[model samples]
Target: MLPLIDGKVVDITGPGRTDRFGVTCTDLGASIIAPNGKLVSVFGDTFSGRRVGQGDWRSPVVLIGMGDANHEIVYEYAGGSDPAYARQLWDYIHDDAASGWRRGGISTVIPSDLLRVGGSLYLHAIVNHGFGDVIWTEIWRSDDSGVSWTHLGEQAKFPADLHDGFAQCWSWDFDPDDGWVYVVATGFQRDKGIILMRVRPDQIGQRSQYSSWGFTDGRWQWGQQATPITPPDEHWGELTLRRTAPGKWVLGGFLASSYALGYRVVSSPVANMYTTPVQTPIVGSSGSQVAQLYGGYLLPGSRFGVTGGVGVVVSQWRTDTGWPYRAMQFKAKLKDTSKTPRTPDPVNL
Candidate 1:
C-alpha cells in the first residue's frame, strides 16, 4: 500500500457548467454505499441554478449517486415555498438511478449521515426551524430504503448552557465489534473542539441510551461527561469516522479556520482519539491550494479490495474559483504507524 503523502489533489468533476449538475452552494456532502454497490450522497443547502455563495434558491437538501455514466440526482427536497418559511414540512427523496431521482414519502426531519444497519436505514441530521438555525441532532429510520421514514426523535442536543459547547452532531458510523453507532459532533459557534458519542445500534433512537466519551484520572471512559476529543485550539467542521479495515479506524474533516482537510488514524475506535493528526493540504493558499475545499470525507467502499488506500470526497467551494459547491474526489493512502516510532509531520499536498 502506498503511504499518504503530499501529492497533487485533482478535481474529478472536471471543468465547465454542464459538468456541474444539481444545486449550487451545496455542501456537507455525506455519503453511504447502497446494497446495490452504488455510492449514494446527500447534500445540505442546495441552490438550484445558483453559484457558490450566491443567493439561496430555497433548496434545503438534494441527493445524488454515482452511476455507470455519471453522477445523477437521486432525489431532492424542494418544498412548495422556501424551506425557511415552511420549516415544519418534512419530506423524503428516493434513489432510483434507472429513472433518475424521484420524489419519495415524507418524514419529520432532514438527513445528514445516512447509515444502514441490518435491515433498517438510519438518518442523522440537524433539526432546524429557522433559516440556518440549528436546533439539535435528530435520528430517523426507514425500513424500505429511502422510500419512507419514521422519526426516531432527538438523538442529541447542545447543552442549554454553553459550558461544554457541544451542539451539532455531524457524522457517524456503525461498529460491528460492539454493535454501537459512534458519532462525532462539534459546537455551533465553530470554535469549540470536537466531542465523541455513541449509542447501541438498537437503542439509537433513545437519547438517554447515548453516552459521551470522557477522560478522567488519566484514563478514557464512556458514560461520563463529554469533553473535547480534539485539541482545544482546533475547531472541526464536517467530519467522518469509519473503519478502513480490520482494527483500523480513520477520522477526517476540515479545519474551520485553515480550510484544510485533515485525518487521524487509530488502531481502534476508542483509542487515542485526542491525539494530533497528520494533515494534508486540500484547499487553501498556503496549503494544497485546491481552493475553498471543505467537508473532506472518506468514501464508504474500498477500491480493488485495498483498504490501505481509499477515495475521499471533498467539497470545493467558490471562494477562489468562480464555481461554488462542487464535489471533488481524491485518493488517500493510510500510513501504518505501528512500524514508525511516531506520527509523521503534516504534509502539504
Candidate 2:
C-alpha cells in the first residue's frame, strides 16, 4: 500500500498535475532507501527554462517524498536566508517575508541545488547576485530523519565554480564503491549545453574540484573543459547508469528522431567510462533512465515489443527540451543477450 500524507491519500493511477501551480520546477536528487523500508526520493523545485530574475523565484525549499507514489514526506528550507515553504503553500502563495530567506524581496532570489551522499544531505545555493555574482554550496545532514538540519560549511562558499563555474547541476547519482558522485549539468558559463562530471561525495562544499568528461574525439576525455554530448540538430532524451551484470556495467541514454529512439547499450571497463556511446538496433521513442536492481533486473524503462524477464519495468515519456517535465511508464521484460553482439555493427570493426 502507498503512504498518505497531510490527511490526503494520493492515488498513483489518478491523473497527475494538480493544476499548474507556478509551473512545477524541475527536481533532482538521489534514488535511495528510507528508514521505513520504502524508497526515498529527494529533489528541489526550480523554473522550467527561465532563471530567477525573469520572475520571482519564491518559496525556496528542498523536498523529500516516497519514490513510488510521490507522497511528500518532508519539505525543508532555511529559516532566515533559506526559507521553508510547506508550512504555508496554498494560503501563503506569494508572501515573501511570511517565511524568511528572501533578501532583495522574493523576485530577485533563487535557491541552490541539493544532493545526497553516503547517508547525508548537501545543498549548494545562490546567495546574492550582481556584477560579481556570488553563490554558495552549503552542506546539511539529518541523522534522525528530516526533522532538523545542521548547516555544515560557509555561505556562498564556492562562487561560480562548483557547478561548472556558472552552470547548475540538474541531475546527480552517487557510486558508493569509490565514493565518486556524478552530476549531469545543463547550464554552464551561462550558455553551454549538457555536460557530465565526477566528484567525490565527500567533497561537497570543499571546492569545485570535480572531473569533467566529454563525448568527443570519438571517445570520452576528462578535463576542466567539456563539450556537449547532444549535438545541435539532435536531441538527447534521457541518461542512466546501471549495473546489469556482476562487475559488468551499462551506460545508457536515449535520443529522439521523427521515427524512433532505440535501445542503445555500451560497456566499459569501469562503470562510467565510455569511449563513445554505441547505439543498438532496438527501435522505440522517448527513452528513460534505467535502474538495475535485484540481481540483473531492469527496474524502470521501456522498449515496445521487448519481453520476458522477471521483475522488470520501464518509464517512458514525451518530453519538452529533452528534459521530461512529465513521464509515462511501461511494463517491459528485460532480455539477456550477453552472448550476442549488443550492436549489429559488430564489436570491433
Number of the predicted model whose lDDT against the real structure is largest: 1
For model 1, residues 95-140, the per-residue Cα lDDT tens digits are: 2334443433211233456776777767667654343345456666
Model 2: lDDT equals: 0.36
> lDDT per prediction?
0.56, 0.36
**How far off is model 2, as Cα RMSD?**
10.0
Minimum summed lDDT over a 10-residue window in model 1 is located at 79-88
Question: Where does candidate 1 clash, by residue pair?
Answer: 74-101
> Model 2 off-target regions past 4 Å?
1-31, 43-85, 88-102, 105-116, 123-140, 145-147, 155-166, 188-192, 214-220, 232-349
Worst 10 residues of 2 by lDDT: 5-14
Query: What are the C-alpha RMSDs, in order, of all predicted structures?
Result: 9.0, 10.0
Which candidate leads the pack in TM-score? 1
